[model samples]
Target: MTEPVSISLTVNGATHDLVVAPRKTLADVLREDLGLTGTHVGCEHGVCGACTILIDGAPARACLTYAVQMEGHELTTIEAVAKSGELTPLQRALTQVHGLQCGFCTPGIVLTFEVWLRDNPDPDEAGVREALSGNICRCTGYQNIVKAVLAAAAEMRRGAGA
Candidate 1:
């Protein structure tokens, strides 16, 4: 058996010191160890964006990342998006537009767009589709998702201007 390695991970603005196996994926460490189950594991493979999380402010697949590799890196999960207990504009738009169904892919989608919308406050439908390509949603047919993203972008832009 491989010995556990102690490492410090900064997640959601909090630092966690944990002893985990070197090979354990960040998804496992986040969900099983840290109790942050919002980052769901879906294909286990990197192809599915279900395990997407932010690594140093960029979206990355938690399933493909080893926990030990996260040391000194800033990680953000869906749990951190609405830390104030209120839904973000994206979350609110997703709900209002019915952008999600089943919800297995919602967290990843939300996380992806949270960063995407920051970089692209005025994205068109094509750009939104491209950004959303990484996430696979089995339900909702993506129409509502696209609408929600556009809606969120506009709402966010308005919020920024205000």
Candidate 2:
């Protein structure tokens, strides 16, 4: 029998001490252990973006990271995207523009767009598509998703300036 290893990690600005198996991936920890089911599991081989989470503010494939390996690193899942009972602009924009359908990929899409918008606050249509090319959303067919990102970017900029 293998003993569970104790490790500490910072998730969404919260620190937690967790007992985990060495073989347990970050995805399992976030979903099964931490009860954060927003990060989906698809193509566990790392090709699909469904399992993407922000590790230290950058998108990472949670399935490829072991729980023990994330010690002391800051992890941000979909739960962190919302703060103070308010949704992030990108999340709200997605809903307003019909950027999501099945909703399976919404979390990843939100996180990815959050990062992209930070770098390209006023991205044009082509730029938005290029930035989001990494994520795959079968339901929205990319049109609404792109529009949502653009709208969110503008809103975010306006808020930042205000």
Candidate 3:
């Protein structure tokens, strides 16, 4: 057995000191160690975005990242997307557009959209689709997902410009 390695990860703007196995994946660390189960694990590989999380405001495949390697890194999950007890514009948009069905992919979808919106708050249809290429939604067929992203972009833009 490998020795437990200590790591401090700032998640959702909260710092957590964890002692974990070096081989533990970030996904496990988030779900098991930190009890942040919103970060799901689908393929246990990098292909599926089920285990996606924001590392320093960018989406990353948590399943592929080691817990020990994330020391001092800022992590964000779906739970942290909201601020001041208000749903993020993306979250509101998803609800408004019925973007989720089973809700299994919602966290990853939210993370992906969060990152995409930061980069392109006024993304076109094709741009929205391209940005969500990595996040697969089996139930929604992606139409609502696209609509949600676009709607969220508009709302966020209005809020920012106001």
Which pairs, if any, clash in model 3? none
List model 3 lDDT by residue over 1-162, tens digit each: 599977788888898988999999999989998999999999887877989999988899999999888877888988876767888888888898899999988999899888888888788999988878888778999999999899999988898993
Q: Candidate 2: worst 10 consecutive residues by lDDT?
A: 131-140
Query: Candidate 2 residues 1-162, lDDT tens each?
Result: 378899998988988888998899999999998898999998788766888899989988898889899987889998887778798888888889888899988888788878878888888999988877777877778999998998898898899893
Q: Where does candidate 1 stray beyond 4 Å?
A: none
Extract clashing residue pairs from model 1.
Answer: none
Encode model 1's per-residue lDDT on 54-158: one tens digit a residue: 999999999999999999999999999999999999999999999998999999999999999988999999999999999999888999999999999999899
| Model 1 lDDT, full chain set | 0.95
The lDDT per prediction is: 0.95, 0.87, 0.88
Model 2, residue 135: what's the lDDT?
78
TM-score winner: 1
For candidate 3, what is the TM-score? 0.94
User: Which candidate number maximizes lDDT?
Assistant: 1
